[model samples]
Target: MSSRDPAPTVSADEGVPAAAGEPSSAAPVEPAPVDVPAPPEPHRSRAAARTWALPVGVGVLVAALFTLYSLAQWRAYVVKSWDLGIFTQLAQRYAALEAPVVHIKGPEYNLLGDHFHPLLVLLGPVYAAFPDAFTLLVVQNVLFGVAAAVVTWAAVPLLGRVVGALVGVAFGLSWGLQHAVDAQFHEIAFAVPLLAISLAAALRERWRTAAVAAALLVLVKEDLGLTTAVLGVVLAWRARRPALLWLTAWGVGGFLVATRVVLPLLNPDGEWAYGSRLDLVAALSDPVGLYDPAKGYTLWLLVVVTGAIALRSPFVLVAGPTLAWRFLSEESGYWAPTWHYSAVLLPVAYLAMLDGIDRARRGRVRWLRRYSRYAPVVGLTASLMLLPQLPLWQLTNPGLHFAGLRAQAARDAMAVVPDGAVVETDVGLMSYLVGRTDVYYLGNDNPVPEYLLIDRQGGGVPQEWGDVLQVAQILHPGVPFEVLHARDGYEVARPLED
Candidate 1:
C-alpha cells in the first residue's frame, strides 16, 4: 500500500525500465549506408591512379633504351646461312622475270613442283621492291617479333595476364636471340607466327580456324602439316564428343584437301612421301642421326613439358597431335633442324604450359599444386636457356658490314677462273657479283658448265661432287683454278686451264 502509487511497473514490451535518475529510453538509432566506388575497367590500371606513374614511365623508358642499343648492335652479331643465299637467288630470279623453283635431289627429296608457298612467294614481291636483301631481312625480324607478342597475348587465357606477359617477353626475346643463327627470312621464322595462331584457334574450340591453320602449316612445309595434324587431334580429343567430330572433320578434311587436292592441283610434282624417319619411335630414338638428343635436349624438354601439361587440360586433344608429330615427323637437314621444327610446335607447348601453370596456381589439381609456384619459374628458365640460340635482332642486319674474310675468300676463288666464262660455284654471292651463270657442280657427275667455281668454306661439298661419276672430276680433274676471292674464310673458284 506504501509503494502502490509510487512504483508504477512497466512491461518489457512497452518500453525500457528507468534507472534511478536517467531518462527512460533513448530513441532507436539507425546506421548510415557505407559508400564504395565501383571497380575500374579491366584494361585500365588502377595502380596508375596513385604512385604507378613514375615506375611505369621509368620502365618504358628503360625498355626503349634497350631496344635502341640492341638495334644498333644487331648487324654485328648475326651469321648467314647457306640456304639464305638460295632463297635470295630465287627471289632475285623471280624479280628478273625468271620462274624460280627450288630443286632438291636426295633420297628424301620433295618432288613438289612450283607449288608456290605463300611465304616463299612473298619473297618475289619483297625482292622486287627492295634494293638490298637487308631490307627484307629487317622486315622479317620486326614481323616475327610482333608475332611472338601477339601470340603470347592471345594465348594467355589458359594461364592469366601476368603469366601471359611473361610468355610474350620470353618468346619475343628468345626469337630475337636465335635470329642470329639462321636466315632471318627462313620459312622457319615465318612459320612461328602461323603456329601460334593455329594453336590459339585450336584451343579456343574454333574448328574452322584451326583447320585452315593446319592446312596452311602443311602448305608451308610438308612435315609441318603432320605436326599440326597431331596437335589438332589432341585439341579435338580434349574438346570431346560432337565437337571433336566437327574438329576432326574440319582439321583432317582441310589437311587432305590442301595437301592432296589443292597443292597437287597447283603443282603436279608437289608430292611428299611419308619417309621411314617419320615413324614416331624412330624419330624419338633418333635412329638415323637426324635428331641428336645431346644437341636437342632443350627443345625436347619443351615438347615433353607441353605434352604433359596438355594432358591435364582440354587442349590435350590438340596437343596430342603435336606431341606425336614432335617425336614422329622427319626433320629437314636444313636451316630448320629438328630443334627448329620443334619451335614450330611452340604454340602447343605454350598452351600446355599455361594450362598446367593455371591449374597449379589455382591449387585445383592435386598433382600440380605442389609445384605450382615453380611452374612458371621452370618455364621462364627453359625459355632463357633456349634464348641465345635464336637471336632476334641479329636477323635485322647481316654481320657483313664490309666485305671481310669470307668476301675476300670468295674473290680469291673467283680469280682462279677465266673472265666472262661460265663457272660452277656454291658461293652464289660471288657468282652474282661476278655476273656468271651456267655454274656447274664441283665434283657432281652432272655435266660441268665451262668451269667449277668452288667455295672452300661451304658445306664440305655436295656428296655427288665427291664421286668419280660426278661431272667435276669426270669432266676435268686437272682443271686449273684460281682462288679469286677470299673473305670470312670463304673461297670462290673457277676452272682456268681445264
Candidate 2:
C-alpha cells in the first residue's frame, strides 16, 4: 500500500499541475523571465576620470610648487652658468633651426656629439617660443611632475589608494628628483617620465605601450639604453613574451653605437672624453678613498626610504646597472646626491616598491603585510623629515631672495655687449649671455673673446681684476681693448674696434 500511495493533489482555483508526490498548493512556483539588460558597461571614460582625478590633482599641486620654486631660483639668479648655460645655448641653436652647437663648451662644440641626447631636440620648439632659461626650468618641473602622476596611477591598483598616493609623493619629493631640478636642466628629466610610463604599462600587461615607452628612453640618454634593456628583460620574463626580447637587443645595441660609433664620430678628439669613467675595476679601487662617507649615507637613505620593499621586486633590477655605473665612476661628483644622476633611479625604486607591496598583500608574509599596510604613512613621514635637506628648503631662506638692483645691473652689462660677439665670462653671467652672444667659460682653454665680462661682486668662479687682465694679455697680445662700461660690479670690456 505504501509503494503506490504518493499522488499529486490539484488546487481548486489555479490550473498549473503539482509534482507527482506533492500537494498542488505546496509546489514551488517558477518566476516569469524578465528582460533585465546588463548594467550598461561602466562608462570607461568616466571610470578613468575617477581613477585619475586624485593623482592628477596631486601631480598638479606638486608640479606647481616645483615650478614656482624653480622660477624663484631663476629670478634670484641662483642658477649656475655651467649646465644651465650649456643647455640654453644648445636649445637656442635648436630654436633657430641650426645645429645644436654650444660655444660655451668650446668655439663650436656640437652638443649631440658630446652626449648623444637627441631628446633635447624636442626642447627646441619650446625654447623657440619662450627662449629663456626659465622656460627650460619650467618644462623640466612639469615633466617630472607628470612622471610622478604616472607613478601614482600605476601604484593605485597594486597598493590601494593611500599607499599609491604616498608612492607618488615620495617619488616627487625624493632628494634625487629635487636635486635634478635644482641643478637645472638635464636629459634625465625626459627619461624619468618615460621609465615610469614603461613600468606602469608593463605592470598592466600593456606590452606594446611598454615596449614603445622603453624604447624611447634611449633617446633621452645613451646610458639609459641599459635601463631600457633591463625593462625588456623584466617584461619578457613576466609576460612570457619572446618578441618583446628584441627591446633588450635594441637597447644594448643602441648604447654601444652611441658610445662607440656615434659619439666618437661626433667628438673632436675622436674619443669620448667621458669614457675614462667606464673602467669599473679602477673606480672600485680608489686608493685615495675620496669616495665620501656622505655619499654612502645618501645611498643607504635612498634604499631605506622605499620601506625596504623595493628590493623584493624584480623590477628593482632595472636600477642595478645605473647604480653600478654611478658608484664605479672615478668622479666624486657621480657619487653624491647633489646632481641629477639619481633622478632616473627614483621612478624605478618607487615602482618596485609598489610591486613589492602587491606581492606581500597576496602572500602570507605577516610582517610584510603589516608593513605594507602602513608603508604610505612611513614613506610620507620620511619624505617630510627629509624635505629640509632638499634644495626646496632654500625657498624659505632669505639668501635666495631676488635682488632687483643687482639683476638690472647684470642685464644692463649684458645689453652693452652686441649680439653675436664672442664673450668670455664667469659661471654666473654665462647663462645670461648664451643665446645673444658666443659665450665661453672664463677658464676653458684659450678663449679669446671680443668682449670680456665679469661681475666683480658675483658669487661664482673667483675672478680678480688681475685674472681678467692676465687672460686678455695672454690671448690677445697687443690688442688694445678698453672698458665699454663698468657699474655696480658688472663690467663689459670691448675691443676698440667694436
Candidate 3:
C-alpha cells in the first residue's frame, strides 16, 4: 500500500485533537515554488559543427591533392628554366644575404631593378632551410591552397556547407589555378590568397580588414595596385562611404607613384618595360587578335557554367583591370592560357559568382531563386568536365616517369660540374645549374663560355654547338676545347689546353 497522506493541521479555535487515521477540517500546507531552467538543445550544437566541417574538409583535401601533384612534377624535373630558374636563383641570393641578382639574364642583372617585388625577400629564410626549386613549388601550391580555403570559408555563410564545399573544389581545380601550378612559381602566388582574403572580407562588409588586405597588393606587384583601386571603388560605391572613396583615390595615386616614380628609380633601365603596350585604341580595334578562340571559349564556358551569375555582382568589376591588361598588352603570351596571367582572375570570378547566387536567393524573382539552389551542382559539373584537360591528369600517363636510368645519368652528369664555374647550357638545363654555376643561356650573341653543356639527343642545344664540337671548336674557334663527358644525349665540353 502507498504511504498515507499527511493529516491536515487542526485550528487552535477548534480545540479538538484529530483521531488516528482521520483528517481534520483545516487547510493543507502549500509547497514553496522553485525555478528550474530547461536543458540546452543538442541539435543546435550538432548543426553548428556540421556547418564548418564540410568546407574545411574540402579545403584540406584539395590543398593536399594539388601539393602532391606539384611535388611530383618537381621530382620529375619537368619544371622549366625561364621562370622557375630565375626565381630560385633570386631566392638563393636572398638566402645568402647577397644582392638578389640573376646570371641567367646576365652577370649582376639585379632582380629588384627588374621588378619591384620586395615581397620575395620574405621567402629568403624558407629557401635557406630547403635550398631548392622544390621549396618554391611547394610554397606556391600552399599559398594557392590557402586561397581556396579562404574562398570556402567565405562561401559557407551564403551557400551553406555542402554548396560551399562544392565551390571550393571547383575553384581549386579551375583551369587558371591548375595552369599556374603547372607553370611553376610567380609573384602572383602571393597575390592569389591576398586577393581572396580581401574580397571575402569585402563581401562581409569588414571594411578595415578589406582595405588593409587590398592595400598590401602593392607589395605583390605594382600593377596590382590598380586592381586594389578597383576594389576600393567597388566598396565605396556599394557601402556609400565617402572615406572608402578616398581609399579608391589613394590607391590610384599609390599605383602611379609605385609604377612611374618608384619603380623607375629602382630599375637599372630607368623605365618600366611592361608599360610599352599602353595604346588603348590599337588594342580595342583588333580584339580578335588579342585572345585565342579556344581561350575565349573557355571564358564563355566559365560564365555559362555558373549560370552567368557572376555578371550580376559588382565584384565582377574587379576582373576588368586584369583582363584589360592582358588583352591590351602587345605580348601574345598574356592572351594565352599558358601562364599565371589569368590565375588572379579565378578568385574574382568565383567570388562574384557566389555573391550573385546569394543575391538571387534574397530577390523577389522566382526563377532566379530556383536556379540559385542548383548553382553548386552546375559549378561541380563544369569543373569535372574540364578536369581531363588539366595537367594533373598527365601524371597518370606512364611516359611521365620521375625516376629512371637515363634521368639518373643526366643528373649525375650535371653533378660533375663544380660550383661557381662559368657554364653555358641549353634552356632546359639552365635551371639546374643556375644556383651553383654561373650559367648562361646557350643562344646567339653569347659571350665565349668556358664550358659548353648540351643535350644532343634532346635537341635543346643550338645546331651550331654540334658543328663546333665536331670541329673541336669553341665559340671563339681559336679556343680549343676537350670533351668532358658524352652519354645518352647529354654532352659536356670544356676549353682545351693551349
Residue-wise C-alpha lDDT for candidate 1, range 340-402, written one tens digit per residue: 444554555665566655556676667677665566666677666654454433334434332
TM-score of 1: 0.60
CA shift of 308, model 2, Å: 0.9
Off by over 4 Å in 2: 1-41, 284-292, 398-405, 445-448, 457-468
The local distance difference test score of model 3 is: 0.76
Best by lDDT: 2
Clashes of each: 60, 0, 1
TM-scores, all models, native as reference: 0.60, 0.86, 0.83
Give the whole-model CA lDDT for all candidates, comma-separated.
0.49, 0.80, 0.76
Highest TM-score model number = 2
The CA lDDT at 137 in model 1 is 51
Worst 10 residues of 2 by lDDT: 459-468
Higher-TM-score candidate among 2 and 3?
A: 2
Per TM-score, what order, best first?
2, 3, 1
> Would you give me the overall lDDT of model 2?
0.80
Q: Give candidate 3 regions above 4 Å deviation.
A: 1-56, 266-268, 285-295, 398-405, 443-450, 456-460, 464-478
